[model samples]
Target: MAGVSRTVACLRFGGDDLDPDEISSVLGREPTYARRKGDVWLTPKGLRRVAKSGIWILNTDDAEPGDLDQQVAALFSGLSEDFSIWRNFARLYGGDIYTGVFLSQSNEGLSISPLTLNSIGVRGLEFGLDIYSNTDDDQKGVSEVADETLD
Candidate 1:
């Protein structure tokens, strides 16, 4: 008889908001390794599977609390080498998720705040913008304005 393997790969981003089974369904395969508690596992073929099927999900809306563009810019500004993988993960999921506000930005720079994903018991993320300027033919003007303070 041969040993059975339930090959699966699971990854938890900061918390258990996402489930491995759910991920398996998305990838249509039995995971060989499970990710949780800030650890990654790989069986003989699990690594290859994960490489082919990138991980990350986005849930954006207008009702999300906080300054959307500012938060995104801040996140980009604060990114370090340590966060390269996660940043890539975010990009793979949809850089649009973070840049939704930029996409919606008008010539006047007026747009609604973009929604962000939040896990239970996790601190709510917020953003503040110091400036939003628009330049046209050597002329610069503030297109949109908001309070610098987050809250």
Candidate 2:
């Protein structure tokens, strides 16, 4: 089995009353997924799901999922470097912006550069990780590693 399979990263912004059109206009980029408040959609399993709030997501995962630093760099690419744009967007929309990273691995780990950390901090965005361990024999051990990494 592979120790580390994939690392996906994305920027997600959500609010109770966010307008997808307005967000697109302000960000000058299209979202991978967007849902307005009250929008209803069917899940992959054919289950009906209704959006409780507005959501805009931009997936910035690199084709090569091995390097998190490269993925983060790609995430900020083509986006404005001016912090005011982000600040104004937060003020106008909602401050519920986050960098979502999903890691699928068995025992391997990765590191994000200080530059990437600084960028996320300057944007006032939360960083969230969902780590999935492939090895079922030691799920608890993997969780302990994840906990330590967070701390």
Candidate 3:
């Protein structure tokens, strides 16, 4: 399907965007929680569905930057390039998904959120963001892509 194929930060997603905590209240949960070993957030039960979080049921309308805002910023900062993409994505998609990464200003880790697409077609991507959230928790040079696991 044609959809957003890019990921970026919402530096330009607007300062007036929705707050993360408010989004959390709407969704009824914290931004991130520890994932128990050998546990999955989503599970299949017959034709029905079950999840530990609403992440799997995320809709483009709910993923908007206004709902998520830069809440991840308190947890994730120092974006080098994706900031531009975030602004563009917000203007185009107006929705997003929290990947559930948590961080304190002194934690030495980066947080990430995904922006879903508005127009899905034969030439578009399923979703896209302008930036890549780096999950290198340690100050070491190790790096892993956040979108990989979020999707």
Candidate 4:
């Protein structure tokens, strides 16, 4: 059998910090699950089955090539759900993606977006950004254009 692999993670904002409905209006795609407790869920399956918790980085391996990769957009879309909503989030907490060390600081820093889903092609769209780890250059696991190259 194929090994278990999934690189999807849920964005964990404070419990009372956001309104799921407002997020829905921003992404133009209704969340698979939206609660007043401030959570918006999405997957290619339309709304998600939340089996895990907190920034789950799941990139499935046994499936066929599909938008499972592009579904990263759905997560990004959640951020753009509303400019005001995201703006408020950035203002209240932090902005952009936080480093692993930053997250380990005195406060529970927020996780924000750094990529823009701008281009579209017949093979679907593409994302151009870098995901790096906090380590020396030799130890760097990811860097430059997180397209399907690593996949």
The TM-scores of all predictions, comma-separated, are 0.21, 0.73, 0.20, 0.31
lDDT (tens digit, per residue) of candidate 3 on 1-151: 2222222222111123334444344334343322222334432223422222222122222222222334334222332233444444344434343233222232233323433222121112233333322443432110112222332
User: Which regions of candidate 2 fall more than 4 Å away from where they truly are?
Assistant: 1-3, 62-65, 88-106, 136-151
What's the CA error at residue 112 for candidate 1, in Å?
12
Clashing pairs in 1: 7-30, 7-31, 7-32, 8-31, 8-32, 8-33, 9-31, 10-35
lDDT winner between 1 and 2, please give it. Answer: 2
Candidate 2, 1-151: lDDT as tens digits:
3324555566666777788888778767888777887889775457787877777776664323455566667766777777777766666555422332333554566677898878876766666765655544433322233222222
lDDT scores for all predictions? 0.28, 0.60, 0.29, 0.31
Instruction: Name the lDDT of candidate 4.
Output: 0.31
- Lowest lDDT sum, 10 consecutive residues, model 4, at 139-148
Q: After superposition, how far is residue 14 of candidate 2 from its true place, in Å?
A: 0.4
Top of the candidates by lDDT: 2
Collision count of model 1? 8
For model 1, the stretches where C-alpha displacement exceeds 4 angstroms are 1-55, 63-66, 70-82, 87-98, 101-107, 110-151
Over 26-83, each residue of candidate 1 has an lDDT whose tens digit, in order, gives 4344433333333343533345222223233222222122244443333333223234
Model 4 lDDT tens row, 58-97? 1222211112233444455423444565555444422232
- What is the lDDT, from 0 to 100, of the residue 70 in candidate 3? 42
Best-first order by lDDT: 2, 4, 3, 1
